[model samples]
Target: MPIAGPWIQLAVKPTAFDSDDRGTWLIFDGLLQAAGAALLIAGIATSGGDEEPALSILPSAGPHHAGLSLAGRF
Candidate 1:
């Protein structure tokens, strides 16, 4: 059986996050996610509303390889 672990993330902005593993990162995906989050936060904040930094749990590498991303955002 494949053991699974939760997705780990480091937030570059509210509503965005990054993974330490290469699997989740498409070409420029990380930059986009971070930038998008930043923009979203900035937009919301600038518009005068409540915005919170959020992290979404992406489908992640299973527990067998869990520690692969344990060192924090790489």
Candidate 2:
């Protein structure tokens, strides 16, 4: 029953490494988590801002052979 109480408390807590000290590993963990979230958001936000290249495909046939050409513009 004692072990079960601690397990239940751990499961109910929001952060596993919660601490009262400001200068603890929890602060660093929070900073790292925020930085990662910011980077992810920035990447997602800027991903669609770039213009895609225009593509062209040309096909040609001659008396003896056939060929295809591909071109693109940024």
Candidate 3:
């Protein structure tokens, strides 16, 4: 079978709708990259390799209550 590379890849900034030239693009791209990096770092620091959001609070009583549980992504 033929290989398909990056069927969908992380976007390079200067989104598809942008109209900036290369010079302006680098600055915004850098800013975008920095923001993404910071977000990644924050996510990693919080979840380590387990990316997930957990219930912050649990109800004391309820027939449908599941209490608190892990909700993972990837």
What are the models' TM-scores?
0.30, 0.35, 0.36
Candidates ranked by TM-score: 3, 2, 1
lDDT winner, 2 or 3: 2
Best by lDDT: 2
lDDT of each: 0.45, 0.60, 0.51
Instruction: Give me the runs in candidate 3 sitting further than 4 Å from their true place.
Output: 1-20, 48-74
Model 3: lDDT to the true structure: 0.51
Question: How would you encode candidate 3's per-residue C-alpha lDDT over 1-74 as one tens digit per residue?
Answer: 11111111223443565454654655565667667778887865776464465444444546876566444443
lDDT of 2 by residue, 1-74 (tens): 32244345445557645455433544465566667778877865664546764689999789999999888654
Ranking by lDDT: 2, 3, 1
- Per-candidate Cα RMSD to the true structure, in Å, reads 17.9, 15.2, 10.6
Error of 3 at 74 (Å): 8.1
Query: Which candidate do you rate higher for lDDT, 1 or 3?
Result: 3
For model 2, the local distance difference test gives 0.60
Q: What is the lDDT of residue 8 in candidate 1?
A: 36
Better of 1 and 2 by lDDT: 2
Q: Looking at candidate 2, what is the lDDT of residue 17?
A: 53
Candidate 1 C-alpha lDDT tens digits along 1-74: 11111123223233444355443553246566667778867775663435444544444577575432323211
- Under the 3 Å rule for N, CA and C atoms, how many clashes does model 3 have? 0
Q: How close is candidate 2 to the true structure, as a TM-score?
A: 0.35
What is the overall TM-score of model 1 with all chains considered together? 0.30
